[model samples]
Target chain A: MTDENIANHLKSLKKYTPARIGVGRTGTRPLTKDFLSFRTDHAAAVDAVYGEVSSKLIEELDLFSVETCYETKDHYLKRPDKGRILSEEAKTIIKEKCTPNPQVQIVVSDGLSASAIDENILDVYPALLDSLSMYGLNIGTPFFVKGGRVACMDDIGEILAPEAFILLIGERPGLVCAHSLSAYMCYQPKKGMKESDRMVISNIHRSGTPAIEAAAHMGTLISKMLDQKKSGVGLVI
Target chain B: MYKKTTLLGITYEFHSLKEIMAKANEEKSGDELAGISAENMKERMAARAVLAETTLSDIRSYPVVAPEKDDVSKLIEENVNEEIYGVIKNWTVADLREYILNDEHLSKELLQIGTGLTSEMIAAVTKIMSNLDLIQAASKITVITHCQTKIGQKGVLASRAQPNHPSDHLAGIRASLFEALSYGIGDAVIGINPVIDTTDNIYALLNETKEVIDRFDIPTQNCVLSHISSQMRAIEKGAPADMIFQSLAGTQTGNESFGISISMLEEATSLIFEKGTAEGQNRWYFETGQGSELSADAHFDVDQLTLESRCYGLAKHFNPFIVNTVVGFIGPEYLYDSKQVIRAGLEDHFMGKIHGLPMGVDVCYTNHMSADQNDMDNLSTLLSTAGVNFVIGVPMADDCMLNYQSLSFHDIATLRNVLGVSAAPEFADWLKKQGLTISSGQLTKQAGDPSFFL
Candidate 1:
């Protein structure tokens, strides 16, 4: 047969025809169904983990002062930029409720993916603080950054000017669970500083990374960053 | 609960213009009589002396002191001498020169001012001059760059031809092209050469380009064209090009080398010849597998490995056909970085492989280099040497597509068009044909039995 005739015949075939290829929709009825399922599963998982870690923190570490507590969706898809800046109410609450100039400030916020912070932050935060305390590093008032991007840490650093600022935020949501939080630490972060300049410990979640371990590592990284007066790729240790 | 914390900070102030000018006038008086333009020089010298004196007075008045970190101080710093007086004397003259040369409008208000010119007028003149310069420069130049592979005894030796890492190179090239085009470079063509073997590197290069687009600003509708070889095409298709082409051709000459079922080859040739012609300036994208051999001898055996080899051979043949009969040839060799592979395959005239092929490929390669320091320097040198015109690397890709990072398809298409490719319209039409179905947070392709190949 001629090339034209053959091409025509091949075009008639089902395989060659363009078709809807549903990517990232595996083992589910539809995308909406799969997404909902993922969200619910992640929320429950995060809640369970948080309950265990927070209880332990309260009982063993005597960590009772709660400045602010809030919840957001797992994917945080509805409010993507929410984590970047503190709300007016949140700012006011922080000013009134928490001590103004503690050696260090500790905050918890749902960042890129709320589920990440929900799943990882509790265990990570306490461990980080414990490590810092051991090093004789006094933390100032700590606050959570909800829906925070990496640059938000710079903003916080500007406001707090804590010898060093530690931000535990969720990494970008991936196919894996959304609750994978990352710890972004910087020494006096300011505007115009590139993201690479901020030190980060990503993948802090249950599946690939464990929270407590990541916290310990993050604490070490922060201490080194402070000691060297550098963060991100510039931090040697 | 959230609270507000007011962080204290300090700001610094600089000397005033009057003080600086006074100091300058004093300094210039000592050097007087050194110039031939006595009158004009005296005025200028006095101005300088006054500027210096003003600076001294301002410094004496303000004094330099380190501010306490937490202290509340005015954040605004005024450098009257540097910004106001210096700009008035230096920038105003520059603006007037530019205005006179370019014949651009000079504001009457600026002339009336005691100072040489107002800041607003200087800014306007500077903007106009810069834009004109950029336009003039862009119209006169076109750049060609490529990335390819060299086949080695062990494997493939990949290198990108640009000073920056492949991505940085792509970004820099795109930025330059966009700047040139925006400044009125008409029909600028950026040729790209890709080194195909492992998709990882190619995808990385594309991703780098994508990163450039994402991180920087570039004007739209700039021309960019890409020429990729068949082997590279096969890699993109995730299959061996020979088998795919054979299957598409409906060639039943099973397991025959160069046999290609004469009828199937003829039919394919006729179809391409009819659709792709020199008069119409039709653009054709060729696909093939990687190899350094080709033979018309029908007695050869055909297997997956051989099929892959033949794809490269097919590329050599198709390249000439496209270049001679069409607007351009998008050869993969230009993109491949492995010098040995390109040398063995194309540079050596497909040594021990295909012979008697037509010439004038008019192709550029794809480069994929990391943002790492070493790679950037190597890429810059390579691009400088190759004089590459265009490139095609991903700005982003879904996890399913080789690289987990995704790129903006719109930017890529626009870049290609800017590089002078007739294929851009067709590619854009194909994308639009996919329609508005969203899947996995991305547009889904439509299910249609459209007979385009026919």
Candidate 2:
């Protein structure tokens, strides 16, 4: 290619997405730095998937803790079904300790990457609580679900009987970005609701959409979802 | 083409550019760029840029041909005739058929063009196309495998020393090639992975490689992989593109990440078919691996390993001369340790072989991977046991530019020693004649052997 052509290729504007392109290649392979960076990113991703959320974060949030059906980390990684429901003892604990029929139910889980919450929750959780309180939405007893998936919010909602449910969970980590989180919200969340029936504000982290900003947006979105009695694709932003 | 399908009760419609695209994501060959297909996209982009630049000035200057004025069949015939390559001059459809039927050593390129023949015309054709014929036509394409010295049979597992440099400087490339050649490796293609992937740089690199091969009289073809479009552009600018090289993904979405689509891939395939003449064989060289889907986020809930297997369908569709799987180059998120990396190599090879691909395992890992040379040794030995087509032969199998560790010339020698397989006959003979090999036809000297005594 000519120098002019090289300049043109370099000048092509890259999209502001966490996609691995525009990073030049050395011949057919990725450049050394790029390859090493990819490795670093990948190592973090694997660690995120396998790592655990800290109990200190849960205690700091002043939330009750419960367990999902998953018996272990390997079980959680391999089985999606187990991560979607409350354990027998955990269901009993939730029924006893948590209030029912609240306006909004806030739940947490290490869905795929614990570091997502371990790192970003301090910024997002308080901001979300402040926003919800400012909106005059009555909040239920907040709690954490260990070894949980996004669908666990439905089970929580069924038990707590909330008007709206917001599950702050870890998004599946990719090599591009690992410390990303999501808030999957649903109006009257219950068992058997399809994935599309839920709405999510994803890519919540410092580098992506700021956790505080996402939490503030989630408050408005949840309020709107409760008013419309819907919270998915049908809800217009 | 449009495909209407339901995945997980969600109905979706996608614009399918190839029949393969309609079937893609359903079973196999899903990703778009599985080879020089990336180049096809780049060329299309380049062409689009030119078209956009001239639109205001040239749009009204050109006369629009009336669709009704052209005969549909005649247009189809003309287009197909123009694309068909490797046939003798002035040969009619019948004449071409006769020529192909009469020649026992017809190039795979010529035979592939036979697929476009009309039904009535095909009926007149006597030679039936088969996979066995494709295997036999291996030496017809301009690939390294098609080098005068045949890809040695009897489970020899043709080898190539792929010395990837930080910069594809001619000297670094030559140093790697010569050192490997000194060890009797790289009877296959002397392919280089350049740091700069552009038409001019790659062309210069390829020309330098050609000079080395010509000067040393090496019995191998030179492959400079600069994406397919740039390679085609370089070739047009007088670059030696002995074999077309491209990286491919398993899913169309993954291929698109590399800036390629099925139609674009087909376009590049046809361009290579038309622009270059092979020594009678398959000319395309493909590189694929696991984790592309995961990296590109196109795995569609499938595991990276399974998705990698599906990618072979893309290589098989094109009839590639060499399909090298860079086993652990993507790093730990996909394949964490040496065990995982080794298993991935074995799985990719088996999957490629099942799809009738000429599989070559680049038993390699990235620097961040918790893998070592011993892991490559184990995996490549296992691959050799399964009769893989080839293994990469770099100086030490550690690519300076790419920052990945792979099998070295010494590793290839080890495989030969342990597995009892030899290099291509011509390369092995050359090694023996040059006193690099002992009488046992291996690189290593026996304990009591005095073939290299002072």
Candidate 3:
């Protein structure tokens, strides 16, 4: 193959995958542009993990805030179990503020990549609300949990005791999409719930699973869970 | 039996051998997270001091997890050459370290000595080793393995061209594989980690990668890394697989969490021998990491390093074609930063080599970890200099599928050139024929162009 032919073929192949192929190299090393671009994407991903969900967005979503037992980003990364339960004050506040035994309880968390919440909540939250309304589900008071993990839904679930629950949480950032979010849904979530009892729709972002589509899909899943009185592996989709 | 030591005028006393082993480890976040690491630097040094004085027999007498309780411990205990163990039964951990680093000992003598050692003994010596000590000791040993082609010979640096796609698109896998082949990579194996772990998915991936190898007439093997059961099903149904792959854990409970067991592995081995394409005696590929047992809640109160070494003991029993520690993928709770990751990578390589396995390293890091491509570059180069068997090569270090960074195809090619090494002999010859590389394994003008295959 000639040089130009190879370049065109490489360009054409790039559409088939997200892998960083076809970027020309310089003597068994990446060219400076491609190298720097990769580093930049990695930097963005790292920053996304360290970034925080802004308060303005939380207020805009009309969600009150609570915190997990983990107080700092470092602690959150080091002790995942700490992120799985509510703080003492958070537990008290949640009990005081939340509506108990609702049909659907929606929660948000900056699980691993806070930027996932920062970038995605606006589109996904509103779409989810509309979709739930379409399903005619009784929505409970929504709130946010800081420095939280996916299992923190169980803590909120214990307090609210919703018939069905959905926690829109941040996924661990990847170079391809740092702002991707995941929606984990469970039926009658409680402490000591088996992980297999929860279902998830992951990679919600502009590029992957579009926010609105994922929200709509999640809404449909919630209805199925309610219908079957189950979620996760038990639910027949 | 003595578990107390004073270093720099600070006294430290560990409650048990497990505590001593965990504290002696160079700062790892996982031990800290488990609430088992030494309380301070002086205490850590004190633990190392006590550990170095501890004898091999002492460690053997007190298995971290007893043989009756865990099959992994039983298997490791069962594999020990009784005659060889008797010879070294009284050697202190410090004596073992000096013996390994001594200039007189070469690959043959060291590997023979390794038969006497248990995984715990190996982990003990590793805890006291410096970075350079780990590198030098490992460099003296060579572990050659063969599947379709020979790998891990002296002056030969192999690379596994991991052409993984997020959705397991065959065309996309081929595209990245072409890029790897163009750089004279994939001498190790054209392995793909399929997104979907079903039999059909693994079967298609295995067939597709095999087709690429056959079409190109490349001296390489093809594998699809799904669950062992999925691979077994695919191979049983006549997928053209070169080897079976599984992620290993160090304990019975940990292995169960991965849904694998000794009997299952034995069954998979038999099936591969009957139905696999590889003609060599070695045909199983196993990957492990530092904190998988802990992640599965099955560490048995053992430190990650000790548990990691035990995985090698189990791997050695299978006589695998290749074994690699997927270093840095377990996240910050285990490794924390580049320093800990680098330390674990070196320690894993040395320990596996000492246990007589064909060891490689997936010199990689996730985004959440406090590491970057520079760390991978450093570790990969360090492992290469230590004569590591192979390093995983993704396209531009970006695995969009597995969602981590590793040594890129370009990086592997550079390591080979900079270290004055070549690919496996058979694959190097093929690279020369394809005009991708010259006789010396240096990239030709035809290199870096995946369209060469097109």
Candidate 4:
């Protein structure tokens, strides 16, 4: 198809989503600009997977730190089970530093993409806290988790005993958006909880759902979860 | 570590694992020639002594293989014997799917013989399906043929090539190509997976691969996989990429887990169809499997096999040249067992062929998966009978880079020997003229011979 004709059809579909549809081609290949952009996006994703969350970010957030059993990225990739729990020292540290029985506990982790944390944690973290405080919600001591997966929240929940908890972690880096983050929320979440019992708000990136907007949405959702005493499948609105 | 040694002035750079194996294979091939005498041994030993300065220790890909067959009693879950008997005697895969389609109260666990089915299930189910149905399953896959030009002569077509290297350095790529030429080698295409996903990397690698094909007179088309869009860029820059490869899942959500969706696939397919070198031009090599739906949290109460069929539904629209299922790569968390894995492979083959898409089986498994070569052998024969178009031709039933075990050259030959089939028509004449009895010949020698590296 001609580039103009392809773009004409794609122009309509492109507005509906950030998907890679309607990407016009040159003869039998992607346009030079699209190809270079794909290269750029892929580079970001690789960087995200390999990059580490900065200590400055943690210090700025004033969040204490703990780590999952995953001591390396290789271990994290192959062993999902190992990535879901706190290390022995980490468990002790979290137990010592964290608040007990708070109405809501917020946690952050560089789950699969440290670049995700680098890009949006600044806006999302503070915005979430402000939104929760505005609702007169009492929050627990927020902490950062190193080498954490989404399920690590359950371990934190078990240690701290919160009514509702949210784990702001990085989603797996992809060529689409390397900095996409997800907020996994659950009510009274404990270890051995099924995945279906957790609720997630994903695609929290600049091009997707903006960080500031998602934080406002997350606070409202957490408030509703506390009101209903439920999350995931049982929680309504 | 790249050894700073020059072979005819080409700096040999490769991972130690790849280097050691390549040099060792070169040594073993020289040692295993025709006859041996004391003088010949002494001379060879003297040469080996000189060669030891640079050559690393031999590393066989399949150093040891487990004994065939696991005890079914220990593998199958308890309390499913009654359902097993019903699947074994009354309903075939199609019948069970009919029940699943009608929303009957059947166990969602009931799947392919390898993943969830027991040895007993394999025994009972194989009797019901027609040999032709098993055979016709692959016919749709191989019937669409592409001609290859070997310096203006017809080359091997409708075959899979051994394509994987750990570091994917030039030395590793060369070693893999040599391994691909060994006995029982021809399958479909030679596709290398570049460690670095870039236009320059893929463009250089595939262009070098074409030189290897011309130099060695290899018969198949070539593909260096980075990503479809990136490959398109390489092609636009004038690289010789035979086709594009991608892993497709059923739903929009499920496909996104692989960093792509159906719409993205549509854009790629439309682009590829418009550009190709072949007169018979069937491009876009797709791979799909069950369990991705569940793994991606998109199954939505749909059975894995049904979700897999929907993946084929997506591939069928583009008229894919080859669509394979990496059935066992997903591991036990999804398929659970050898029975489930095997049954899923067959189910996918059936569905792909039914969708009028060419289907191949990556009759493969990972170490973490609850399957062995014995189980893969069973599936290979069943798929061969059911007409699976081709399989991934890895060295010694293993891919060093992909980290998965697949049908070795020996397994392919053994299957073809029993089934009375050979390579596609393009290579059949060559196989005969060379007097290359692939199925009848022995690809596996006794222990101590250096294994080929790819």
On lDDT, the leading prediction is 3
lDDT of 3 by residue, B1-454 (tens): 4476677776777888999999899998898888888888888888898899999999999899989989999999999999998988999999999999999999998999999899999999999999999999999999998888899899989999999998999999999999889888898889999899999999999999999999988998988888999999999899999999999999999999999999999999999999999999899999999999999999977899999999999999999999999999999989999999999999999999999999999999999899999999899999999999999999999998999999899899999999998899999999998878887778998789887788
Worst 10 residues of 4 chain A by lDDT: A19-28
Question: By TM-score, highest first, what's the ranking?
Answer: 3, 4, 2, 1
lDDT of 2 by residue, A1-237 (tens): 555654453333221112233343332233577556755765786688778889988999998889999998755653556788899999999999888999999988888888898988899999999999889999999898888988888888788889999899988775556778999899898888977889888889888899778978998998898888887889877
TM-score of 3: 0.98
lDDT of 4 at B134: 35
lDDT of 1 by residue, B1-454 (tens): 1111121332212233322122222111111211211134344344333322232223223321111310101111121223334444433333443333442322232222212222222212222233233222222222111111011111111111111122324433443223222211211112223333244444444444334333432111111112222323323543211111231110122223333443444454444334321222122233232221111212112111222322323333232211111101111111123232222122211110111121111122211101121222233223212222222222111111121121112222232233332222222233334341222212232211122212
Candidate 1, residue A16: CA error in Å? Answer: 26
* Lowest summed lDDT window (length 10), candidate 2 chain B: B445-454
Q: Between candidates 1 and 4, which one is better according to TM-score?
A: 4
* Weakest ten-residue segment in model 3 chain A by summed lDDT: A1-10
DockQ of each: 0.02, 0.03, 0.81, 0.01
> Where does the lowest 10-residue lDDT sum fall in candidate 1 chain B?
B149-158
lDDT of each: 0.33, 0.63, 0.92, 0.61
Docking class of 1: incorrect
Please report, as a residue range, the 10-residue window in candidate 2 chain A with the lowest summed lDDT.
A13-22
Question: Each model's TM-score, in the order given?
Answer: 0.32, 0.47, 0.98, 0.49
TM-score for candidate 4, residues paired by index: 0.49
Better of 3 and 4 by DockQ: 3
